[model samples]
Target: MNLSVEKCPRCKAALEVKENPSCKAIVIKACPAGHYEKEFHPALETYIEINKVP
Candidate 1:
């Protein structure tokens, strides 16, 4: 993450960014009031795509 000031785009509240606890490959950045949410699968998604057989 940027480590800079992160805020919810919807309500302008502070966002909580953390790992999924059970799954390290997944990153969650969400607003506290459920205004916004996002999931990032950085390396796993790319690795899967690159290894997929055409």
Candidate 2:
């Protein structure tokens, strides 16, 4: 799970991060009082192919 190392947006509470049941992306559950969750998708990072070298 890709948990955000940041505080909750609403109440400044600790965020709980977990992987989705069906997908590889992660879901963040935070602010128990507010009762909300957010989805976090990992960026598809890759290096591009180039003909010229630096």
Measure candidate 2: CA RMSD. Answer: 13.8
lDDT of 1 at 8: 71
Q: TM-score, each model? A: 0.58, 0.42
Per-residue lDDT tens digits of candidate 1, residues 1-54?
A: 566766776677776875577988777777777766667777656321111112
After superposition, candidate 1 runs with Cα above 4 Å error: 1-3, 44-54
**lDDT digits (tens) for residues 1-54 of candidate 2:** 547565455566665665468876544444445444554545644322212112
Candidate 2: stretches off by over 4 Å: 1-4, 43-54
Best by lDDT: 1
Going through the candidates in the order shown, the clash numbers are 0, 0
lDDT to native, each model: 0.63, 0.49
Model 1 sits at a Cα RMSD from the real structure of 9.7
Q: lDDT (0-100) at residue 7 of candidate 2? A: 49
